[model samples]
Target chain A: MADESGVLVLGDSTGGELSSMSRELLTAGRKAADDLGEELAIGLLGATLDQPSQQAISYGADKVYAVTHPQLAQYQVDLYLAAMEALCRDVSPRIVLIGRTNEGRELAPRLAFRLGVGLAQDCLEISVDAGSKTLLANRPVYGGNAIAVVRCNYTPQIAAIRPKVYEPLEPDSSRQGQVVSFPVELDPSQARSQVVNVVEEAAEGVKLEDARVVVSGGRGLGGPEPFKDLETLANLLGGAVGASRAAVDSGWVPSSYQVGLTGKTITPEVYITVAISGASQHMAGCSGAKVIVAINKDAESNIFKEARYGVVGDWEQVVPAFTEAVRELTQS
Target chain B: MPVSIAVLAKQVIDPEMPMAAFRIDADAKAVVPPSNIPPVVNGFDENAVEAALQIKDSQEASITVISTGTSFALDVMKKPLSMGADELVLLQDDAFENSIDSFFTAQLLAAAIRKLGGFDLIICGRQASDWDNAQVPLGVAEILGLSCISLGKKVEIKDGKVSVERITNDGYEVVEAPLPALVTVSNELGQPRYPTLRGIMAATRKQPTIWSSADLDADASQLEPRITLQELFVPVRDQQCEIIEGDDAADAGRQLALKLREAKLI
Candidate 1:
């Protein structure tokens, strides 16, 4: 009976590995399931995702349903939507959770529409309402200036949870669960959009999402050349270099390195914001960082209000020296 | 054959309005439109219009602009018309006045598109600036059983096929689909061109065709929002700034590093 109506978590895999966002969703799903007195099930759809299915079990999924097909290697809207829709029909879950990833954003809405369910996109928090027994999805609106607690009036409530908002539980190697193979058929003609090629940006060191220490520069840096100093500091800290939307829009940095509402959301141990005014949109992405250090010449900069430690100084004069100090401190 | 393109535009409260001026009525769970800052075309939707206009510029094509809301300020909605849209269709009804979710919006928009007839392509912003929910384009395409390319930075139609450069996490991907599809344009496509004097004057002569829910034959039941707003509030921050003092800028940098190290953050 529990298998028939459990909390379903959509496991997103990239390059045959479970995405960080998927793991985060599982963590969130676990809590919601516990609160609702239901079991948690994970759905993995890909050409090859056996390893990630087992990993999901260790992360707290009681059952793992994987659908594999050759056409599932690359993300196609039709194939994925059909697979998930089929799964939902087979196992009528009370709630469905998907990561707010590139693919998830596209798939979640379509699934909800097909299921005739309600959907909450890019949610920051998810919990069960004690009295109503309905799911409450907290999402930011108006560029993160305010948050709205949204509830779906329909069954099988669906939500696309943002990455880094919930921490994944520690994996227990000894844990075991049922792995079910779900069959799915794909026709070549169904795929309207075909991915000709994927071009990855040339980036060295840690990826922005995985970086523990993020060194981000803003328009305050004045130009792209100053990013070199940020790179040096990021390298010394063994982290990644990021940028504000202003810097990216100014053509000082590529869009991939941007950190803001329209860009990637990052939750690092330490986020060093240089010359950023901390616009609400930008803060929406990095507010999850454990500690924020802001450096700007303007004392009234908005970034300072959110930063744990702030230095009112020019980047050119402060960054190089800061890099040198960090290098020395880490070398010893 | 000349191509027919329909661009979806939305009027949203300017996202760039300063935080201090932004206000929300918690009880109503609605944003109080700052009178000083009037509603403008969502920035990304402007990019979508620009994408459609560029295609219109290079080829023989007709561009139709569509928007759905309770009341669209003509002054704001006419910006797309002034920029060279062949026609503007406004979907307005009192039932849509409240907080309608994306599903209902997409369903109505899809129905309206069907009523318009003979559109080879549909374009929409990656997401609205106010709600920031990038779901409508895909939802509309799903309802119409059409292909959708999301976050397209570049789009072109030739020989009844659509080619698009889609923005990805790392970089971008080149994808292709048959005509009679939809694509959502991102800001990476570039800033939209401003209207010229001649174009503005021509817009003054053009009137938008307004369609209510009755004309579209929209199902009032389906038009109802599935999602309900439970509560709305501003997130409060308890942290205060602790400015690190230093003799100079460089010294301040050193002190900052030391403080971070002490916190074991580095």
Candidate 2:
């Protein structure tokens, strides 16, 4: 079903690992297509398409425009944006959705500007109005306290959706897709950025963004050493370790694990904050957590107000009890 | 040559308030306003101001601050101008309250910047706090047709091209592009500077250049929303917290272990 405004989903495959974000985009795109009564087309831009193209179909893309170029092997903004502009011009999509990963965060705005349209970034949810065919994009605003519904009056209403905000449907390996080869021409010398290396995270169990249970630590833990207990609990539960901006700025954890307005936004089943004094900045990252447990020495800490369960005790004593109790319960 | 840089900033509700203070209208897909919402410069845009200051710190440059909102919102956006800005542009309009979307927001700023002229660089936070769509920089870059870099954590200008270190989960990617490009700053870019007393005095006396939609030369049709937000709602939070029943310390461990296993973990 094609309408006045078509849908184009964009994905970037780095070193053969189709970004989890790309998969999430496909999921959202598939749903948007069904709701809008439009065909979903995907643009896979990279140096190669061997593994990613297949994954795109499994995730739910009907047609894939694969552009393989030597210069594209590296994620160059100019090259990629230029290619995307060309693709959008050819397809004339009413809505262009990209993942809020590093590339999408940068590219969508540029693409929207080039097309002279409106663009929404890092949206949590997007839907199309049946009669008007207008896209209603919902995203966190003012940290995480408020959400704004954005509508683009212009054509090619482009947007970047955050990863993990939406759940992906089970992949059907049998799903087939049409592969349209897009020939990309680029000058190697024209690109300013070169991919010197790719460093992957070595964490096991659940990825940070996709984690169900998140165990977070803050400055109240006193030092970085105490977080070992928190990490142990997270690992045992097959979850991820998150940190407050205080802990990250204190060098207790890498900035990657930081959760706050300036850090990663997560929505987990359970979030346990150890020795953390709740600040608006820190809480912004974890407000979406379903269950919050705060263990702190300060009885009047603001974290208690946000916590489902509050333990007004030392972290050293509480973390061990919580961990040991879980250990025994699981063992039984 | 040092580039002229302009930053568009906005005041947004603090998102990390307690549930008691916030409410979500799930059906409307919008968050209900809490009475105690504190104002702050949108997170990503602070990095933009810092990026502009960095360019000024390294070379001879003029950085201006532009904001679109109520006069009361001035305190939220003016801090950066005092920290180290050469000028300030304010587009205060009542319609701006509902027109926070990046498209029109960009149009408002682009009109002012275009009128100012002689700008070699533009910096914006990836997104505003209230909108958090991260679209303005790319939109402004596109409207101007200059190259654009988003999530730039580190930036340097040399030989008419700006080199930037963009932060990614994998690490940082270094890219260089020609001048007259737009760069959106990442949180890791650097800490924003506090305004000095002398700088504060200057900002107090400084008259921000004001422009209306008429002055901007923007199409009224383009200003009209393509998408309409019918309603706003806040999400409801429900948590089921259960305490483990046990006697001795070791026994408590057993109870906790049982719960973990019940959740399918060893």
Candidate 3:
């Protein structure tokens, strides 16, 4: 399962399941291995992970290092990171990559500390330094104001990449790979931060991340009155409702419902911005949407520049008409 | 009681900087701003300052303000000293800002505090407005080997032990930890108070002591930047504006419908 460059990716599992960001890491890992002419191996650390290992294989992992143990079933920071660290020590990988999720953010740093090397987090981009084989990691700095390139001089150069930045490889069901199940040795008592409870959000229909169509209202909605209109439109079009940071800051909307850098990053099929001015910080989260439509009174609003289609009219007049038209089309 | 408390403060680019001042220089491949980008004590840090002051008001603890920044920070950081931190430590060497990662910053602060000694609590904003890393407290805790509770929206100290109410998505988690712990305050904790003119006048005479990487006994290798920033620029957007034209309301509805159909959204 070792590549020519000996690069291997360790897939992170949260809540006893594979995270969405893991696929993106695999994509980047595969690309990096391809560039280095190495086979990209994946170390999937979990308790019992046959299905997720096969899924990883389909996503361009050459070999899956299936480290299993009853103690590793849940995310215990110390135990989980120790398992991955032990795997890397044995495998002797030249480069290691992980998803920049909560688990990755915590694990990579601790693992790097244990391994006595530097670890990079939240990298928007990564490339191998041709001369040095140093993994160059580009991460957002200054609150999305600037990007800094981070490099590791130590062996097994590690990186944690943000999700959605790298497109996942086409999954092939027939793809084949080896799964070597290794026994993990650790006790749960060693964990620092215990997960007392795992509570999932109540809303089930369409997660903000996975939603194809999103209708977002902002502070300009004035109050809860226009929210009904926005929700009506979202429901009519089978979309989720998003709100700008301004709306959240103004207390017009909950922070969970806000869409921006601090909020959830969405890559919906279509996004409608109602009264959003498209500030740079806010745009970072929503820029991934496929089709953007801006509806604002100001023709020169920043949202207009980012939207694919815009209406420079009052949303009060435009929303109802837009809702009716969507119903007419979807119903037909 | 000889209890000393260190409050972490940061100077950030004012959150309300005008958009008109933002300009992208193609040659520099960076965002060129008009000279009016003023620095201020980050709003969250101000909350931390007020929290520190509240403790100093009643508990009779020595309050110290610690910050990591460059020359631009000195002006804005004065607010905290005026608000009543008994002393100030500014880590402003060239190497400090060059690296300035959470781990390094925490290491430096912990070293400085260790030199001073006898600190009961360390106060800081839950997250900084500029970096928003939220790692300093955790990093400091790990470095100093102390207990830390973050996102403290409400804090109360009694009998030398601290009671902190942490705001989470569900509701709040109230935890009681012993003294010599690190606590970071958020906006949800309380609004920061405005300094009076008398307080401002007193602050004018106060000077924060500047410490370098050497002063903190931090190794050069430990403080080096892991991430290198190549460029900074605003992302390009590809939005096109199209007005749905019609003379009447019915015509407008029909036109909008036609536009949706044409785009295959129907």
Please report the candidate that would top lDDT against the real structure: 1
Per-residue lDDT over A95-183 for candidate 1, one digit per residue giving the tens place of the 0 to 100 score:
99998877776788889988877799899999987556689989998888889889998878899998789988998868888999998
Residue-by-residue lDDT tens digits, candidate 1, B115-167: 98848999999888777778788888887888878888889997788899888
lDDT of 3 by residue, B116-197 (tens): 7737888888667555555666566656755566667666677777667754433346655677777777665666777778
Error of 3 at A168 (Å): 2.5
DockQ comparisons of all candidates to the true complex = 0.78, 0.35, 0.34
List TM-scores for all candidates, in order.
0.96, 0.84, 0.84
Worst 10 residues of 3 chain B by lDDT: B226-235
Candidate 3 lDDT (Cα, 0 to 1): 0.70
Output the better candidate (2/3) by DockQ: 2
Residue A161 deviation, candidate 2, in Å? 2.5
lDDT of each: 0.87, 0.73, 0.70
TM-score of chain A of each: 0.94, 0.86, 0.87
lDDT of 3 by residue, A1-332 (tens): 23325578888665655566777888898878877777788888777888888888898888888888888776565678778878988888878887755355446655665665556666778887666666877766555555555666567787767667888888897988787887768875555433333334323366667778888987677876787788888887778887886676566555557676655678887888888888766776787788788777787777777787767677787777777877787888
Q: Over 4 Å off in model 1, which ranges?
A: A1-4, B98-100
Q: What is the interface RMSD of candidate 1, in Å?
A: 1.3
Give me the runs in candidate 3 sitting further than 4 Å from their true place. A1-5, A14-17, A88-92, A105-116, A142-150, A195-204, B1-5, B23-34, B43-63, B81-87, B98-104, B118-138, B146-206, B231-234, B243-258
Docking class of 2: acceptable
